[model samples]
Target: MQINGAQMVIEALIAEGVDTVFGYPGGAIMNVYDEIYKQKDFKHILTRHEQAAVHAAEGYAKVSGKVGVAMITSGPGFTNAVTGLADAYMDSIPLVVISGQVPMSLIGTDAFQEIDAVGISRSCTKHNYLVTKAQDLPRVLKEAFHIAATGRPGPVHVDIPKDVTAEIAEFDYSIVLDLETYKPHVKGNPRQIKKVMEAIANAKRPLFYLGGGIINANAAYEVRDLVQKTGIPAVETFMARGVLSCDDQLLIGMLGMHGSYASNMAMSETDLVIGLGVRFDDRVTGKLSEFAKNASVIHVDIDPASISKLVNADYPIVGDVKNVVNEMLELIAGIESQKYKVWRETVQNFAKLHPLTYHEDTERLKPQWVIQRVGELLGDSANISTDVGQHQMWTGQFYPFTRPRQFISSGGLGTMGFGFPAAIGVKAATPEKISINFTGDGSILMNVQELMTAVGNKLPVINIILNNNYLGMVRQWQTLFYDKRHSETDLSVQPDFVKLAEAFGGIGYRVKTKEEFDSALKDAVEKNVVAFIEVIVHRMENVMPMVPAGGSLFNMMLLEKKGEK
Candidate 1:
């Protein structure tokens, strides 16, 4: 079949099973947008900013476990996506970002809407390509999708020149992708699996540290089964919150900078740490020299570069998380479960002693209480997205998500203003399930215009704003480390969030108490409309269980008495 390059791109995407795309239109990309307008097979979300488009695609990918696709124009439009590209790069998300560029002939003449997008995105992407001819369009696109969705998946950039998109080409949608430089390892070595099994069986106090890779690889059940069969306690990273149910007996709480005290203690005392599908970021391994000093680490990751990069492991296996975990489970099929009653009891005692507590007053609303109630109302089936702030910390602490991909947030990048648009994407991808965005007043205001996108698409997403009247996370840092100097952290001029939602043709409610929260949530869920519920909280409230920056995990600041820091 023969078609224009623009039509070929859309057709190829359809064949690739991309049901939804988030994008913005401009001069250089008008041909692609025009092609998209003629098709109703796939959904396109119009975002106010290019960055929102990328983040929304990220949200969709995280929830659907598919390669997220986002399209944009040239120059500033392409540059606007850099932040999101970097975010996905650091988090290892599978994304295909298509950006328009100047025609091939005018490459270096400073043409209108011209920018070196490939060069700009090279460092931030897993791989990138610039299509110089129409004949290469289909192959380049196929390669881009393959690279983006392969092992250790991350963002990939395809810079399509305007001339290339307009050129007529012979499009064969069934061509096999044959890129030699892009092969991904999908299976674990049998010897490596046996080595890990032996280590697990020999260790008395073994712990499994799970991360987002489990969800990405759809191996949550396999991971859970291995832990149960081996009788090893597992702790999840923040992004891997829902890998194991909070009530699972073998599961400990999250581990990292703001993780539970018991989890940190367990990591400290473990004899073997099996890191499954997680990168050992600095936050997870505080003071790297002393992190898991007594443990023999077995690191399993799809990306070869991540192995032995930060924290050296005794054994490293490079393969898909699902395949690797399954192989290990098969190898250790008959291994008897070890009794670690003393070890489990010791951790349980620490958890009870240093339980996560928040002050509850009838006069004022607490963020933790609101998160707990929201989790209770939505149950475990709902998808939740969060912005970076105190609310993010509280949600991680309170929400009990047992299913994978139920919780989405910017963990590694810690990008603010990610919640609302992300919620819209999640709702778009999973229309049958209810999605909510937990945001702070400061973070919501960063991309509040996205409320229009939600209403325009009729995405019934609930937006919960934690109105603390300040930049909560920054203020907490200032209070704790900067000698109580307020600096410019206070956000006194707050927007009327309820009115803002109304302007966008969405429902809005202001909640200040438990009864108000119940009413607002009930109305939001019952009504088929985009809803915003602003929960007003104290300005001085902060997320507790904080380990000071650059400090050891043992030295934690427990916020008990006000003004006692």
Candidate 2:
């Protein structure tokens, strides 16, 4: 059958089992938008901006464990979505972004809304394509989805010219992709798996340092299986927050610069480090020379290049994390679990010494308390999202994630204005569960326009603004290292968030006390509507357990402010 490229795009998406698409319409992509309007097989979320569209796609992918699809127009529209591309690329989120381009005849003419998207996005995207021919659209679109969801997943950009979308072509969704060099290995070598099993058995103090790849590769079940069978203490990186449930006996808290005292201490003293899909990020590895000095690492990751790139692996197994960990489980049935009993007790003592704490005062509302209250109020019923800053760290510290993909945020890029749109997407993907975003006053305003999107779409995502009125993280650094010469971090003069939320046709609240916060939270969750709570917290609160840059994780300040408790 003959069909236009726009119709083929929709048909291919439906064939790929895509149920949702986040996008914005424009002149260059009007043909595709017209087809989207005519189709009823899937849903399209009209986000407020191009950036928010891609972010919503990310949120959808994170929770659904499926490839996210998004669409946008050319020129500035394409440029606007760059942040989301880079964020997904850094974090290995699978995304297929279809961006419209000027007609083929206008190439290199600097035509209206024309730019080299392939050039601009080459570095950030895992792969990209410029589709000028209608006959190739079927294979290119299929390939984009394949590449985006395959090994070391990242965003794949497909630039379709406006003229191509309007042209007629024979449609075929069953066309076999011809690329043979794109295979991704999924199974582990038996010998390497045996070596890892031996290391786990012979070690005295072994720890499992997990990363986002565990979640991306869908290896949570295998990892949890391995951890439970071996009785090894586990510490999750920020992106791998909920691999082990908070109540899991062997689970250590998140380990990084702002990790728990118990986790950092355990990492410093471990003898065998079983690294599962972790890149050993600088945040997790404070000082390279001092990080895990006493340990020999057995690293398992699908990306071969990531192995021994930063930290040399004593036993490197380059295969899918799930497959490798599953193979270990087969061999792990013969091992005993009593070796790390003393090490576990020592780590627990470290936690008892200085737990994740804030000055629990009755007068002022601390950011930690606000985040904790949210966790207490909406356990299991809601998933958490956050924009970057002190609030992001506070949520990471206070909120206990019990399942994978329950906590979504920009881990690598640390992008502000990510949470609100992400929550919108999460809500869109799963309307049965409430979506909550914990954002800072500084971060929320970056994409505040998304409030309209949420309200218009009837996707009720609660926004908890930790209203500190200053860029809290940077201010803490200035106070600690710069002799308190506060620079341009103060954000005291901003619009009333409550009024802003109300202006966007959503519910709003301003809470100054804990009692008020508790009341506001109860009302918001019960109302089940798009709401924003402007929590008037202490203006200068800091994230503790600070491992100063270039310093050892073993040494950290456990205070709200330096030299002051």
Candidate 3:
């Protein structure tokens, strides 16, 4: 059967079982858009900006456990999507971006709306292709999907020329090519599994440190099962928020710079750290030499480079996290749980002695309380996302995620404008589930234009803005480290968020007190419309249990008791 390259693109998408595509159209990609218009097989989200399109796709991918697809024209359109590509690359999110390029004849001619799309995207994407031949489009498209979804997933780019899209091609979507060099190890070595089992059995104080790879590998259940069976305390990274239920007894809070006092303390004391699907990023391993100093690490990750790049692993298992963990579980099945009664007691005491506490005043709204309330209101139904700032940390601190991929944030890149657009994608992917964006006053404005995207699609996502009238995170750092020298951090000139939401055709509310917040939240939940609720929080309030940059994790600044060096 013969088909145009544009139609082949659609056929390839259908073959890949892609149900949704987030995109923005331009002259170079008009043919693809025209084919998209003719097709009823997939839902196309027309985002306000090219960046939002990618972010939206990320949100969809994060929750759906599927490779996200994004499409845009070449030149500025491709350039605008760069930040999102970098963000996805950093976080290892699987995304296949199809970009339309200028006609092949215009190559090196500096044609209008032409840029080196493949060259520019090479650094950020796992792999990229420039498809000049129409007949090769199907195989390249298939390869793009495979590359994006395999071996520590990341974005893959495919640049198609306009002339190619117009050319006819012999279409054969049924052919599945297996590239030998692209093989990913899915099983852990038996010897490595035995070593991990030995570590689990020998250690009196065992800890499980996790990251997004668990969720990406669909191994959250295995992680929970491993911890439950082995009786090891666990601390997750920001990207691995919901791997274990928040109320699980063995689960300590997140481990990082803004990690809970208990989690940091527990990490410092552990004798064996089972690092599953996590890279020991500097933020999590503050003052690397001192981080888990007492412990020997058994790092399991699909990416071999991540195993010892930052923190050296005693037992490095290079395979899929799910496979490695499940294999370890099988090996340790009949083994008795270690008698770590003293260790458990110590961990519990640490959790009790330095609990996550804020000045709980009913008069003024605290960001922590607002997040806690949202967590309570949404409960297991919560599918929350966040932009980078104080609010992001606050949600990380207070939001009790009970399921994997329920909490989505740009952990690696810490992109500011990610939440609102991501929330739109989440809503689109799972319309029955409730989606919310916990954003800051500063971060929300970065991609607030997506409010129209939500309204246009009727996605009915709720945006809860923690309005502090300042860049809260930077202000905290300035207050602590820089002698309170407030520079451009103060964001006093802000739009009335309520009116702004209304102008964008969404319901909005501004709440100053807990009573107002509760009411607004209830209204947002019941209304079933795209809504924005701005909760005014204190400007000076900071996320506690913060391990200052270059500071030891053992030495943290608690809100109740600030230790002086």
Candidate 4:
């Protein structure tokens, strides 16, 4: 068969099992968009902003465990995707971003709508290429997908010139991808695995610190099995939330800054810390010297750079998380479960003493209560996305995720306006499962135009807005650290979210009390159309158990009441 480069690109994407793509069409990419229209297999999501398209693709990839794909035009369209590419790079997300470039003949003549996308994205992407010839399209695409999805998983770019899309080529669907420059480490060394197993067996107080890599590698069951077999308690990072059931006896919840006191204490007191697929980010380690001072660290990761990039490890194994865990499991297959009864008892005692708790008032609907109720309603099946702010932290503290990839949020980037569009992407990827977006009043206003996209696509995602009438997180900081002088945090001038939803042709409800919240939630879940629920919460309320910026985890401000200072 023979086809143009644009058609060949779409065919290659279909062959790679890509069924959904988020993108915004523009002048330079009209040819590719036309090819997309001709194809019946792929579904395209039109976003209000090109940036949202990239973020939606990221959310899809995060939840589905697939390489997310996004398409855009040259110049401004390509520029808009830079932030998303950087975010994915920082978080190690798998993404294939295809951008339309100017014609090859106008390469150095400063053609209209022309910018070197490959050059611009090189710093942030895992790999990139400029497809000048039509014959190279299929092979380049296959290699791009391979590189983007394999080890360390990050964004990859393919810059397709407008003229190249129209060039005809012999499109043979059968072609092997051979890239000498690109190879990802997948297998762990047997010796290293044996050493880690021996350390695990000998340690009296061993802990497993899981990260997003486990989810990316689809090793959740293996992780759980290893923890159960060794009788070792496990804690997850913010990005790795829901890797294990929160109620599981061996699960110690999240650790590090803003984590539970018991979790932080457990990490600090451990004899050995087995970190799997997790980077020791500053948010997780706090003062590097003080982090797990008593523990001998064994780090396993696919990216060799991350092994000793932060806190030095006693043992470093570079390989895929699933492969490494499998190797370790094989090494310790028949070993009897060690007795950590004392360690378990100590952790449980701490948990009981400082359990996660919040006050509930019947007079007003609280964000924490709403999140808890939603968690109960959805059980362990629903996928939750959150925007950055007070609601984001509230969801982190309140929601109970029983599996990996069930909780998706912008932890590293802390990008506001990430929730609603992310929920749309999650719903698109998993159409049968219910998806919810927990958003703050300030965060929602950043990309509220995405509400129209949700309604247009008929994606029935429940958007829960925690209306605090101010930027809750910043206001709390101002109140605590800055003489209680609230400056520029007021959000009272914002439009009514309920009316906004109505104008976007979606169902809207406002809840003021607990009863109203419960009723509205129930109604929203049952409704077939996209729904938005705004819960008015008390003003000037702050999130407790806070470690001030650049402060040690041990030094926390436990504010119990208003005006505690």
Q: Which stretches of candidate 1 lie over 4 Å from their true place?
A: 561-565
lDDT of 1 at 108: 89
- Residue pairs clashing, model 3: none
Q: Across residues 1-565, which tens digit of lDDT does each residue of candidate 1 receive?
A: 7788899899989989989999999988889999999998899999888888999999999998899999999999999998889888888889999998888898889999888899899999999999887788888888888889888889999999888899998988689877776677879888988988888877878889999889888999999888888877888998898899878988888877788888888888889889999888888878777788899999998888889998898899989999999888788764567556667787788788887678786688988889898888887768999998899998898887878899989888888988887888899889998899999988998788888888888888898998988899999999888989989888888778899899999999998889989999998999969988999987788787876766666666775864444
lDDT of candidate model 2 versus the reference: 0.90
Which ranges in model 4 have alpha carbons more than 4 Å from their true place? Answer: 333-338, 559-565
Candidate 2 lDDT over residue span 1-565, tens digit each = 7999999999999999999999999989999999999989999989989999999999999988899999999998999999999989988999999999999999899999999999999999999999989999999999999999988899999999999999999999898888888888777778988988988898999999999999998888788888988888998898898888878888889888899888999999999999998999999999999999999999998888899999999999988998888788889865788877888898889888888788865667999998888778787778888999889988888897888888899999999999999988888887888899999888998899999899998999999998878988888899889999779988999997788989999999999998899999889888988999998888777798889988999999787533465
Full-model lDDT for every candidate: 0.87, 0.90, 0.91, 0.86
Candidate 4 positional error at 111, Å:
3.5
Off by over 4 Å in 2: 560-565
Comparison by TM-score, 1 against 4, better one: 1
Clashes in each model (backbone N, CA, C under 3 Å)? 0, 0, 0, 0
lDDT (C-alpha) at residue 514 in model 4: 76
In candidate 3, what are the lDDT values of residues 1-565, reduced to their tens digit? 8999999999999989999999999999999999999999999999999999999999999989899999999999999999899999999999999999999999789999999999999999888999999999989998899889999999999999999999997999777887888888878888978978987888889889988999999999998998888887899998899999999989889989999989999999999998999999889999999989999999999998898998889999999999888888788764465587788889999989998878775556889999999888888887999999999998988998999989889999999999998998888888888999999999999999999899999999899999889999999999999999988999999998999999999999999988888999889989988898998888789899899999999899888654432
Candidate 3 minimal-lDDT segment of 10 residues: 556-565
Q: After superposition, how far is residue 237 of candidate 3 from its true place, in Å?
A: 0.9
Give the total clashing residue pairs for model 1.
0
| Cα lDDT for residue 151, candidate 2 | 87
Q: Which 10-residue span in candidate 4 carries the lowest summed lDDT?
A: 556-565
